[model samples]
Target: MIDRDTVRHVARLSRLRLSDEEQETMREELSGILEHIEHIQSLDLDDVPITTHVVEVENVLGEDVPHEELSVEEALREAPEVAGGGFSVPRMG
Candidate 1:
């Protein structure tokens, strides 16, 4: 829970200018945020498994196919500039 003075102090540290009414409002809002965090902390999670992904996801089956490899000339044809059989760009200097 935050009081008006604490809110005002925080506002000063953050370079924020708030009216008296805004100070009171911020106090209430901060208090509510703390209360909500406390509520979340009250939950029991003893039996829950730690999961990195949200859903029960799996790699969908796909054909084991190989793609045709592109030749150097075919690959370099799309570049705006090329030199010495390689794609070229502007000099860093």
Candidate 2:
């Protein structure tokens, strides 16, 4: 049973400023959500299988093929700066 105080506490924790009307609405909505969860919990699913997804999925990507490697000059052609036969990127802190 989600109450007004619980909603207000959650709002405070989330750093949200809810009006009185919004708080009341949130309380009702949260209570309804809890009720729905309780209803779902009451269902009998002893034979039901736990699954991560509802539909079966398979990798659709095609096989990888070997490709010719690019030369250092070709790779660094569009780079803003080049040093020591490679792209010179900005240093990170």
Candidate 3:
């Protein structure tokens, strides 16, 4: 269990200043957190396989084919502004 002194030490290392009430509260909260972690640590997991996610998933189907090449003129035909046969935009600062 974490005590007020330990909590104060932690707060000092973290560059925090806690009041007496806050220190007591943090000590209790941290003790509870440690107890919960200890409980989780006591669980048996020898037969359990490690996994990244809890649920299994499958890949979704995508488009069957890829895009074909387009002619330069066809590609630039819809451009709002063109200079030297290439798409152009305003200069930015």
Candidate 4:
């Protein structure tokens, strides 16, 4: 069971400002989630395989092939701003 104190502590750790009603709602919701997890833990699945995903997946990306490299002048031709033979971007604080 999720207690009010636990909920309050979690809210504090997450820097959340919750009203009294919200804290109570969170306690009930968290308790329900824990109950569901407990039910899942009680399931017997000795023959079930451990899998990250439920469905089979295959790589859909195209084959990697080497391509001709672009020249420095060609690369910088479309730049909005260029400096020192490279693209110049705005400075970030």
Candidate 5:
């Protein structure tokens, strides 16, 4: 069980300025959370497989298939800058 002193110490370590009422509330909540965790720890999980999610997810992706190729002119039709028969821009060092 989370005591008042433990709650105050935790709050101080976390740089929190909790009031007396808030500290009492936090103490009860933390104690409840620990109790729940203890109950969960007592459960039998040997038959359950560890998973990231409850539902099974798969990558339902389609096969990559190439289509008709685009010509240089068609490709550079809407380009802002054009160079020597290709897309051009600022020079890189």
Candidate 6:
């Protein structure tokens, strides 16, 4: 999400002086735009053969039969946050 500070920075670069209300509005709009772009970029289109139209793209995926390999306490059971044995998030300022 775009922050208020980012909105202010953009306004400054564009040589604009926005009111607080306008800044908040721009923040929401720009955040939405960026989020939409990110969602598009995250789509898995590897199976879609670069067509100009949209229809019949199939990859149905299901053929990797390798099982039984979760030993770290059954992969941290139902971890919401496991520390040293993997997966523990929240540290990005």
Q: Which candidate comes out best when scored by lDDT? A: 4
What does candidate 3 score in Cα RMSD to the true structure? 13.1
Give one digit per residue, the lDDT tens place, for model 2 in 1-93.
Answer: 888889999999998999999999999988988887887787899998988877889858966998778987899999999999987888985
Candidate 3: tens digits of C-alpha lDDT, residues 1-93: 997779989999998989999999899999998987897687899998889877788877978897777988998999999888899999974
Query: Which portions of model 1 show Cα errors greater than 4 Å?
Result: 39-93
Worst 10 residues of 1 by lDDT: 36-45
lDDT of 5 at 81: 92
Residue pairs in collision within model 4: none
TM values, all candidates: 0.41, 0.42, 0.43, 0.43, 0.43, 0.42
What would the C-alpha RMSD of candidate 5 be, to one decimal place?
13.5
For all the candidates, what are their Cα RMSDs to the real structure? Answer: 11.9, 9.8, 13.1, 8.8, 13.5, 13.3
lDDT of candidate 5 at residue 56, scale 0 to 100: 80
* Cα shift from native, residue 68, model 3 (Å): 38
Which 10 successive residues of model 4 have the least lDDT summed? 54-63
- Give me the displacement of residue 76 in model 6, in angstroms: 74
Q: Go through the candidates in order and give each one's C-alpha lDDT.
A: 0.89, 0.89, 0.89, 0.93, 0.90, 0.88
Clashes of 4: 0
To one decimal, what is the Cα RMSD in angstroms of model 6 from the true structure?
13.3
Q: What is candidate 5's lDDT per residue for 1-93, written digit by digit as tens? A: 889999989998998999999999999999998997897788899999888877888968977998778988999999999988898888885
Residue pairs that clash (backbone atoms under 3 angstroms), model 6: none
| Superposition error at 86 for model 2 (Å) | 33
lDDT of 1 by residue, 1-93 (tens): 788889988999998999999999889999998987887677798888878888888979977899778989999999999999998999886
Off by over 4 Å in 2: 40-93
TM-score of 5: 0.43
Candidate 4 local Cα displacement, residue 2, angstroms: 0.6
Q: Residue 22 in candidate 2 has what lDDT?
A: 98
Clashing pairs in 3: none
Leading candidate by TM-score? 4
